[model samples]
Target: MLHEIVISGFGGQGALFAGQLLAYGALEEGWHVTWIPSYGPEMRGGTANCTVIISDEEIGSPLTRHPTAAIVMNLPSYERFEPLIAPGGVLVVNASLIAQKSQRADIRIIYAPANDIAAELGAAQMANVVLVGAMLAATGALQFETLDQVLDKHISARHRDKLELNKRALRRGGALAV
Candidate 1:
């Protein structure tokens, strides 16, 4: 199976990091994976995104014109990527930050209040992780256990203290998907 996913949001919102976590989990599962990150020049608060491709076979390209799934953390990202999802694909929207509702009928839309959930978890920065959890439940691209492993093995030492919080955010988001 091949799953191409895009994660988009403002810089510093952990969009790229969320994609990296997916890549790491895919890699651990012995799948072929590629991650490409992009961001505007304005840096933090600017637009940032990353594309992650996970497949059982060798991948030929890193770019995808229409992804199989996407996680949009803001209205701008939601507007930009909503139309780019392939038919029958999944779209995870951050409902806490976006005011507009999705109009697409061909794709599955999951509205997750990531920001509010993260705030309740006491770390708004983990909103991205919350979305990742939602993506995990919605797509089943990677196992939840694999994500837990990725968090434990791949997170940097400096951020180790927030590991549990991240896990909680992930669980909260996954709950939304169910």
Candidate 2:
């Protein structure tokens, strides 16, 4: 199977980090993965997006023109990439940040209040993780255990204290997906 996902939001929202975690989880599953992030000109407080591809076979391109899924963390991202999702693809949108929805009928859209959920979990910064959880629930691209392992492996020592909160967000998101 091949899964291509794009995660996009304003800078500092951990959009790129979420993509990295997804790629890492796919890698642990023994899949070939690639992650490519694009930053806006201003860097801070600007739009940022990352493309992650996970495939069981050789991956020819890191860039995805039409992704199988998307995690839109902001309105701008939804506006920009909504048209790019393939038919029958899945989209997980952060309803706390994005106010609009995609008009397409061919895709499955999941509205997750990720930021609000993370904030309630006392780790507002882990909104990305919440979205990731929702995506896993919606698409089953990787197992929840895979995500947990990725978090354990990728979270820095400095952020160790916030692990519980992130886990909580992930659980909440997964619940919503169900």
Candidate 3:
């Protein structure tokens, strides 16, 4: 299986971190993977996006013009990547920030109230993690176990106290898929 995924949101929204986690999980699974991140100079409020490709076989290229899945955490990201998603591909939308709907009918769209969901879990800024779960749930691209492992290994030791919140955020977001 091959999954070309694009994750986009504002710079502080952790879009790059989400891509890293996906790459880490795929790497742990022994799948071929690549992660590329891009952002504007303004940082925080500026746009940030990342592309993650996971495949059973070697990837021919890192460039993805049309991805198999897209995780949009804001209205701008949604507007930007919605048209770039492949037909029948999974599109995880952050309904918490985006009130507009995608015009494309060819894609499978999943609305993830990331901010709301994270707030409910008491970590309002962890909406990225929420969208991660929704992406996994909607696309069946990765397992929560792997996501947990990635967090365990990648998240700095000093910030380990928040591990449980991240785990909960992922599980909660995954639950939204059902």
Candidate 4:
């Protein structure tokens, strides 16, 4: 199956990293994948977004107009993309950062306290990983083990030390789905 996923949030929230991880995991799973990151000029405080496409067949275009799933790390991200989610799509929001809720009835929406969960894990930066965990649970796009492998392979050596903690955050996020 082919799936389009969009992840958005403010810069420094690791939106791009999460999208990259998903795309990398899809590749490891033997799927065709593409990752595209888009952002405004504000750097760390600016809006950052990425589109990831995973398919069993060759991907025609990397650009996604309407995605089948979305991970919104902040209110702005949610407001900007929630309306464009495809019918039957699943939207995962970071409840700790996003104050609003999606009103669409045609899709499934999940709100997780990602920031709080990351804080509890002693690594507030892992908030994005929590969202990724929730996305994995909601969409089943990638396996947790595959995600871990991608993280280990792609994360910078400086941050590689935190791999286990990030994986814990993913597991915690996945627990929310249960």
* TM-score leader: 1
Q: Whose lDDT is greatest here?
A: 1
The deviation in Å at residue 142 for candidate 2 is 0.5
TM, every model:
0.97, 0.96, 0.95, 0.96
Off by over 4 Å in 3: 39-42
Instruction: Write one digit per residue (lDDT tens) for candidate 1, span 112-138.
Output: 999999999998889999999999899
Displacement of residue 34 (Cα, Å) in model 4 is 0.5
RMSD of 1: 1.0
Per-candidate alpha-carbon RMSD to the true structure: 1.0, 1.1, 1.2, 1.1
Q: Is candidate 3 or candidate 4 better by lDDT?
A: 4
1-178 per-residue lDDT for model 2 (tens digits) = 9899999999889999999999899989999999999855837589999999999999999999899999998898998889999998999999997788667899999999998988888878988999999888988889988888888888989899987777778889989889
Q: In model 2, which range of ten residues has the least summed lDDT?
A: 37-46
lDDT, candidate 4, 22-90, per-residue tens? 989999999999999995584798899999999999999998889999999988999888999999998
**Deviation from native of the Cα of residue 2 in model 3, angstroms:** 0.6
Task: Report lDDT per candidate.
Answer: 0.93, 0.89, 0.90, 0.91
| lDDT order of candidates, top first | 1, 4, 3, 2
